[model samples]
Target: MQGKRVVVTGGTTGIGRAIVRSLASQGARVVTLGRDENALKDALDAMADLPGEVHGIAADLATREGVERLFAEADVRLGGVDALVSNAALGAEPIDEMADDDWRYVVEVNLVAAMAATRAALARLGKGGQIVIVGSISAEIHAPGESVYSATKAGLQGFAETLRKEVEERGLRVALVEPGTTGSDMQEASDDEQREEIAKARMLRAEDVAEAVDFILSRPPRVDVVTLRLEPRLQELP
Candidate 1:
């Protein structure tokens, strides 16, 4: 991975953060984005000793302008892009229970932003460039009370699958990583509850998903991992 240039959205915390660290450790130059300025600073500081260079951009993916700014900074920081990881997402309450604006913001962040980022990256990506979308198993399970969130994920599932076929002719690889019951800031479970579940092999850590991403990118140019689903050993489905 040495000297590879990559971009990762929503990379200041949770799974995205883990992916950034993993890539940096292997000497990949990465530009990552977050909505929080402090989190962006912290993420950059934390990677100071890694072999790879890391840059952080504070941008709100919920808006088109923010997405534009992110890629603009990426273009300046990395010069060119080799991989783009669309990992930013927002969890939402049930559609009926949420305020109209709130639900719409969730869609903007979780779904629309991904599409925008992918579009920008495709313009810059060349043959052998990788696009990895961090999706969720909720799209498949469709658990109750996750109407809005599930809808966005289901949209990503279709987006990633269809996009892969469209870009395969160009030698661009697209992969989707769907994780189930991950312990992240977006999780509703308390810290103790999450820890207990992790210990029981019923919940996955953010780093687990990061590793899956690294594996996908590490594959030979001839190999394309279309989709990889990761669930804890004891995770139960609705």
Candidate 2:
């Protein structure tokens, strides 16, 4: 991964942070984006001692202007992008009970932003570049209270499938990594005990998902990893 130019979204915490750290630690030039300025500072501070180059950008992917700004900065900082990790997303409530704005926000962040980022990245990504979409196992299991989140993730899966074919002739690879019940702030545990329970054998750690992303990116140009699903040993579906 030495000197490889990479971009990561939602990279202040959770799985996104892990991916940033992993790539940067391996000597990749990494530019990560998040919505919070302070959080972005903290992320850059956390990587101060790393051997590779890592920069933090504050941008909200929900807006077209913000997305364009991110890509423009990437052009200036990284020269060209070799890999893009679309990891920014939020959990959502049931569709029927969710307000219209709430539904739109979730869709814009999870689905639309991913497509926008990929579209921009393609302009900078030459042959042998990679696009990794961080998805959720909820898309496959269809958990009852998370209809909106599941629907968006399912849409991402479809997007990745078609994108791989569209970009195949260009020597680009598009892959999806869907992790189940990861231990992160996004889990929204109610209390300390609940957090402990969720952190136990029932959940996959953020590093686990990061490792999946690293593996997909490390593959040679001739190989394309279509989809990877990661779940804890004891996790079960109903």
Candidate 3:
């Protein structure tokens, strides 16, 4: 990963933050984005001592304009893009219970933003460039009370699969990492409860997902890891 220029979205907290640290620790120049300025600053400060360059941008990904600005900044920061990690997502209440604007915003940030980011990245990425989408196992399990969130993740599954076929011949690799019951800010459980679940092996840590991403990107150019499903050892299916 040395000298690789990468972009990670929604990287101020949770899984995305872990991915940024993992990549930077391995000597990859990383530029990450999040909507919260303070969180972005904190994340950048925390990663200041990593082996590689780590930069943060505060940009909302819920709109095309924001995504465009993010890529524009990345162009200036990294000069070129070697990899793109679409990891930003928003949780939502059940479709029937959520306000129209709220649900639409979830769809925008979780699904539409990812597609937009991917499209923007494709324009800059060349051979051996990689695209990794951080998805969720909720898509497959269809857990109750997660209709909106599940729908977005399921959409990502389709996007990643079809995109891989379309880009493979160009030497670009696309992969999806679906994690189950991860302990992150998106989780409804409290931090203490999440810690307990993690200790009991009923929940996965954000770093676990980060490792999966690193593993995918570290592979030889000839190998394309299409899909990786990572779940807690004892996570129950709905």
Scored against the true structure, residue 180 in model 3 reaches a CA lDDT of 94
> Which TM-score value belongs to model 3?
0.98
Residue 146, model 1: Cα distance from true site in angstroms? 0.7
lDDT of 1 by residue, 27-51 (tens): 9999999999999999999999999
Lowest summed lDDT window (length 10), candidate 1? 56-65
Q: Per-residue lDDT of 35-145 in model 3, one digit per residue for the tens?
A: 999999999999999999998778889887789888898899899999999999999999999899999999999999999999999999998999999999988999999
Q: Candidate 2 or 3, higher lDDT?
A: 3
Give residue 25's lDDT in candidate 2 (0 to 100): 94
Better of 1 and 2 by lDDT: 1
Candidate 2 local Cα displacement, residue 227, angstroms: 0.4
Every model's TM-score: 0.98, 0.96, 0.98
State the TM-score for model 1. 0.98
Stretches of model 3 off by over 4 angstroms after superposition: none
All candidates' lDDT scores?
A: 0.94, 0.90, 0.94
lDDT score for candidate 3 against the true structure: 0.94
For model 3, give the 10-residue run with minimal summed lDDT: 56-65
Residue 32 miss distance in model 2 (angstroms): 1.3
